[model samples]
Target: MFQKILIANRGEIALRILRAAKELGIATVAVHSTADAEAMHVKLADESVCIGPPAARDSYLNIPALLTACEITGADAIHPGYGFLSENARFADILAEHKIAFIGPKADHIRIMGDKIEAKRTAKALGIPCVPGSEGGITDDEEALQVAEKIGYPVLVKAASGGGGRGMKVARTKADLSDALAMARTEAKAAFGDDAVYLEKYLEKPRHIEIQVLGDGKGNAIHLGERDCSIQRRHQKLWEEGPSPALDDRQREDIGEIVAAAMRKLGYIGVGTVEFLYENGQFFFIEMNTRIQVEHPVTEMITGIDLVNEQIKIAAGLPLTIQQSDVRLSGHAIECRVNAENPENFRPSPGRISYYHPPGGLGVRVDSAVYQGYLIPPNYDSLVGKLVVHGRTRSEALMRLRRALDEFVIDGIETTLPLFRVLVRNADMQNGDYDIHWLEHFLADGGMSAQ
Candidate 1:
């Protein structure tokens, strides 16, 4: 076991890793930006260091500063809690050169899975279902257009190095393909510094389901089941739940097997997610996230696993302590991303939180970093907290989530709580018949327009 670990990120995830390490008797060193010097994670960590200015590029994404912090603090390992440099293969390699363990997948696996084009090829090689599209990266607009035509009328142009909904464009006709392709490439180049783009047959109204897989270094891997993340806006997940309401037992087993096989084939280790798009009762591989997901708490709630601790243990050369049969989904769980933004216009509202009151009860858990009088900086993501709940059934979980959302209150900044309240009460959401476009259409049709 590592005596000390440096957390290379901030917000609730940093605090989450800190708590897990503390339980395992591991000291934690938190590295934060100048704006987050007084953040909760910094206060809770055994040691804290300021990396750089408020901008993420100069701090959280700064490899030299992070390595320096790890060296000075004598951290045996570094835990990047989602986002920033968590999935960065170069960072992993740098840590390995320094003899510091990166608490995630192997550097090679990260490199392979980080590229969408390579990931699709990998899935195909492993016999996993992947969307029909271009065999690999399309080098030019003509190549993109040709691929789009072969894939049929509706095609999606995506960045080879993209995630989080950026660098993507959907074209419904041949006339739209060239422009969409150019736009996608430009966005990808600007966002990831890679001008590569690929094409895939677009599946309209597909449910975004992902399987959470954990592996030990010895090539053994198992999945904890799936999370239905169809509730999203602009490619960002809003609410996620376990044991997808749309999938049957057979479907679940099939998808889980495919994900596990892929991970094992790649020699993947630690915590990761294999995302898929399910449409017309068929599942197609999309991409893999090489780090802990924001909605991971829902999986833990149902499976009774501490993913963070497992990540650290795996990095420390510990084999997986649990087996596939040992993992069982006991109940339904849901997580609502509480962001400090206007529920109406969806604009970020950053300011001091005059009051912070979190809901608590049986089956309800709140993962947050804010306290009363805490000032939310305008420099980063507007997410302030997450409200997660579990229950014996989907209906029970929904009701519990509704009640919890009502109880959550954060003053002096706009939040999505009001929007969530309206969402849970909608007919489609209540019936569990909602698709990826449900939220967008709902909001466009005056769901949040009223207030």
Candidate 2:
């Protein structure tokens, strides 16, 4: 195990890494932007350093500052929790040059899986199914139109290097294809610095599912089951659950094993998620997240494994302790992303939180960095926390989520608490009958109005 680890991110995820490292007898160093000086993670770390100013480019995303902090603090490893530079392949290579381990997948894997087009090819080569579309990068409008027609209507034009629902556009008819293709490429270039885009047949009403896998980069890997993340808004997942209501036991075993096998074949390292679009009893590979996911807590609730702990250990050359047969889903788990935004308009709500009281009870957990008087800086993502709940059954989990949402209190700001409160009682949500586009349509149609 590493003697010391530096968390190269902020907010709840940084705190999440800090606690896991501490539990494993590893010292932690917290690096923060100027705006996050009073963050809970900074307060709890063994030592904290101010990396840069409030701007992410000058702060958390600054490579030199992060490495300098590790150099000064003698942290041998850096854990990039989720966003920022977590999935950046170049950042991983830089850590290697400094002899500091990046507690995630290898740089090569990150680069390969980062590109959506290449990821689909890899999945197809590994015998994992992929959505039918263009062969590779489509630059010719005529060729794109041909692929679109062959794949049928409602095709999705996606960025080869896209993520977070950016750099993607949908065209329901042939007339909408050319503009969608051009716009997707433009957005992809601006967002990811890559102008390449591809096409795929858009499957209507598919549940977004992802399989979590941990690998040692030494021919050993294990799958920790799956998470249903179909409840989304503008392609961003809002609520996630484990042991998808859409899948059966046989479906789970088949897909989980296939994911583990693919990881072993690819020599994948650390923690990663193999995302898929499941529809009509078929699982089609979408993309792979080369780092820990925000909804990981839901998987942790079902399985008694600490994913962060395993991620750290694997990066240090330790093999997995659990096997395929050892992994088991105990119960139902749910995670609602609590963002600092208006529940109705979804506009950002960043300011001083005057009063903060999180819900507490059996099977309720909130991973957050906010306090009664903490001033929420507006320079970063709108997310302020995550509410994770577990229950013996899916029905019980819904009940617990409802009660917990009612008890959660935060003043001086608008939160998605009201949205979650409304969603918990939603018949469709309760029945687990929602697709990726369901939330947006629901919100637009007064689902978020009076609530």
Candidate 3:
């Protein structure tokens, strides 16, 4: 086991990694910027180091500063909790060159999966079904048109280098194909420094589903199940649930087995998510996330498996302790991301929190770093907290989430709580009949009659 691990991120995920390491009797070093000196993770860590200023570019994303922190702390491993440098293949390679283990997949795997175009090819080669589209990057307008026509209308022009819904443009008809291709290329170059873009047949009513898997990098692996991340806005997932209402036990089991077999064949290590777009009972694989996802809490709730801990163990050269037969999904779980934003306009709202109270009870877990009097700096992502709930059934979980949301209080700042309160009462959300576009359409149609 690693004696000391340095967490190279911030917010709830940093705190999450710290706790998991501590539970395993491993010391943790929390690296933070000046704005996060008073952050909960820093205070709770065995030691702390100020990496840089408030700007993420100079702080959290600063590679040299993080390596220096690890050197000073004599940490043996780095756990990049989800975002920031988590998926940076160069960063992982550098750490490995310095004899420091990265608590994730190998640098080679990260490099392969980091590129959206290559990831699709790799997944398809592994026998995973993919959305019909281009064979590779489209170099010009002619290629783009050919791909669009072959794939039929309603194609998505997307960046080959990065994701997070950026560098993407959709065209529903042949007339719009050229504009989408140009726009996507421009955005891809500006956002990811890569002008490479590809085309794909876009599903109109696809559900965003992802399978969670853990591996030892030595041919052993297992799948935890699937998460329904269909409730999203502008491609950002707001709410997530485990044991997707869209799939029955047979479908879930079959998909889980396929994912596990693929991971085992590829020798994929640590924790990773295989995301997909589902429509009409058919799943078309999307690009896989090379690191832990933001919605991992819901998976943990149902499987009772500590994914972070498993990642650490795998990085420490340990084999998976549980097998596919040992795995079992017990209940339903849901997670609502509480962001510091206006409920109506969804504008960032970063300011001092006058009052705060997180709901507490059985089957409820709140992951956050905010507290009363804490000032939320506008230098980072707007996510301030995550409220996760679990129950024996989906109905019970939904009710628990509603009650928890009512109890959660963060005064002096706008949050998405109001929007969630309204969403929970919607018929589509209640019956789990929503797709990726459902949230946007609901918002357009007046979210809640009272909102």
Give the clash count for each candidate.
0, 0, 0
Q: Count backbone clashes in candidate 2.
A: 0
Better candidate number, 1 or 3, judged by lDDT: 3
After superposition, the stretches of candidate 2 with alpha carbons farther than 4 Å from their true spots are none
lDDT of 2 at 255: 94
- Candidate 3, residues 286-354: lDDT per residue as tens digits? 888878888999999999999998999999999998899888999999999999999877999999999
**lDDT score, candidate 3:** 0.92
Instruction: Report every candidate's CA lDDT.
Output: 0.91, 0.93, 0.92
TM-score, predicted candidate 1 vs. hidden true structure: 0.98
Q: Determine which window of 10 residues in candidate 1 has minimal summed lDDT.
A: 442-451
Clashing pairs in 1: none
- Best of the two (2, 3) by lDDT: 2
lDDT of 2 by residue, 1-451 (tens): 8999999999999999999999999999999999999999999999999999999999999999998999899999999999999999999999999899999998989998998888899989887878888889997899999999899999999999959889899999999998998899889899989999999999988989999998988898989989999998888988999989999999998998999999999999999999999999999899999999999999999998999999999999898877888888999999999999999888999999999999999999999988999999999989989999999999999999999999999999989999999999999999988888888889778877656
* For model 2, the run of ten residues with the poorest summed lDDT: 442-451
Cα error of candidate 2 at position 265, Å: 0.4
